[model samples]
Target: MSKALQEDSKARVKVLGSLLHTADISNPMKPWDICAYLADRCLEEFFAQGDQEKELGIPVQMLNDREKVNRCTSQVGFIEFVITPLAEQMVIIFPTLSFLTRNLSLNVELWAELWKNSFDPPTEDYEKLMARVNKVVSRCRAAGPWEEEAPMRQSSAQSLLSGSESVVTEH
Candidate 1:
């Protein structure tokens, strides 16, 4: 049986199992515009957990309450503490999935650049970055998914910083 076989309680198998997750690794391989829209919807859902908890007089858990949470800080911490480590372990377990972590690192950079008090209004740079994310997302969604990868473009963080959707296409 495969080491990853379910319910095989060997310590080694259990250790390997712990590394697995169905996490959305920063929407890699998806159209960026669609990914961004999905990300926004996901954010709304995640933060709403806090609002619901508060109404019930329950202590909101980490990442549950948006009013009390700092999106930037929460984002970086989640990436650094949770996603990055899990992704790294999974990469070791399945090296081909290293692709999952590439754009994830870029998102960490974006969030880190946007880091500020959650209560403070967004900075010009933060707003600009978000606009760029939405613009790329909108374009991709309108165009629909691609059959082939955009071979020439670097990471979106680079494109976001440069303000160009420099995805190369064959003419």
Candidate 2:
């Protein structure tokens, strides 16, 4: 229902809309524990919707059906197909946004690892999964937006103080 979703929007407007949409779906780029918590909450909402659909005698959507859906598989598919592709395209528009791609790749790698071991239990113990997740979270935290602040912000500040117009781009 957003104007950005309209097919006839101007190029700049469409790009901005797409950027906003990408950010909305970029929750997986957050710290692992927080990302996992958000994902769990989303699934809970889907399950509730499924329950309502059932009560209304309507068929449940594949993702919303708690009984039939495989959480690990679904999450892996979402990250691989949805988040990764979006982040890749977004980086083209805002080159400094590669951090989004990096964080998303980390999340996808972690999710893919979990998905691969979903059936091969004993090897995928809680400790091992948590260790991998924690590592990714730490790496993501270190590579977050704050990491780029110093050079870019400092350059902009210096340029402003010198009354010079300069643009700083993260390579």
Candidate 3:
């Protein structure tokens, strides 16, 4: 058990415990592919719940509504808004657990890329989507604290843009 998880604060015990138990550090060795699979399964459960809710004449949870949900973007929001912040705060309390935040950060980046690609796709292609996912998965670095941290790459609009792509658009 992580030292952070073991210590429970009275004022924030409920939330703190929830975040600690669900954070990446709780299952550090979990494979990325398995994580994606589990997320898909969880979404199915949510969709089922929404269906049941509709049958019962109740309002469905916003994201749980199968018709409106975008798997990639919803996941990105959850990880970015909830999980990453929790993991990052935990890292501050336990510097040794910094790797947890690094893993989470990369996960958010992956989801963002997926969202950017499929945000408004008029047509879906399973083979192409899987190829993109696999390519992104291939480039993911393992969350190993022992590995040397790579230097951050610097980029600006001038360096990144060459074609008709504009960083900002006029309304």
Candidate 4:
């Protein structure tokens, strides 16, 4: 059973990585749009891989563009239906998701502080970097279940300087 669960998790991670990479290449700076697209793809794959009527608890046919558009527009509705549930699942299957969120949140806050001191007329490179940062921050913030959890404590000052340090310490 544990092996099967591991295999299922591996499959989901592969699918998620594929979806994220596809969205990154195709939609570049639009995080929300990319997330919406991936969510749709996830729903499709989830249904295709399982007994939709029994396993999903929701009708696969109803997961159409119209419904997606409606849900995406309503932040409360989107969180309730998509982000909340996915975050819960991530805690079980992808502990890294929680770690990623914590790191990204810290990065976003750090970047915002840096920007305050470094504020100037935005260069093209700066704008692009900011866009990428924002995308990561938004995704992290939207990773629902981990949002309310206590922020992970940092043990070393070096961890504050390099985000990669946290990943190393975690292992």
Relative to the true structure, candidate 1 reaches a TM of 0.52
- Candidate 4: the clashing residue pairs are none
Query: Which has the higher TM-score value, candidate number 1 or candidate number 2?
Result: 2
lDDT of 3 at 117: 46
Candidate 4 Cα deviation (angstroms), residue 28: 20
**Segments of candidate 2 deviating more than 4 angstroms:** 1-9, 116-118, 121-171
- Could you say which candidate leads in TM-score? 2
Point out the worst 10-residue segment of candidate 3 by lDDT.
151-160
Q: Which one is best on lDDT?
A: 2
- All models, RMSD in angstroms: 11.3, 14.5, 11.8, 16.1
Alpha carbon lDDT at 88, candidate 2: 61
Please give the lDDT score at residue 92 for candidate 1: 58
User: Candidate 3: which stretches are off by over 4 Å?
Assistant: 1-20, 23-31, 119-171
lDDT of 1: 0.50
lDDT of 4: 0.42
- Judged by lDDT relative to the true structure, which candidate is superior, 1 or 4? 1
Better of 2 and 4 by lDDT: 2
Query: Candidate 1 or 4, higher TM-score?
Result: 1
lDDT of 1 by residue, 46-73 (tens): 7688789888999988767666665554
The residue-level lDDT of candidate 1 at 101 comes to 52
Which candidate model has the greater lDDT, 3 or 4? 3
| Cα misplacement distance, residue 78 of candidate 4 (Å) | 28
**Would you list the clashing residue pairs of candidate 2?**
none
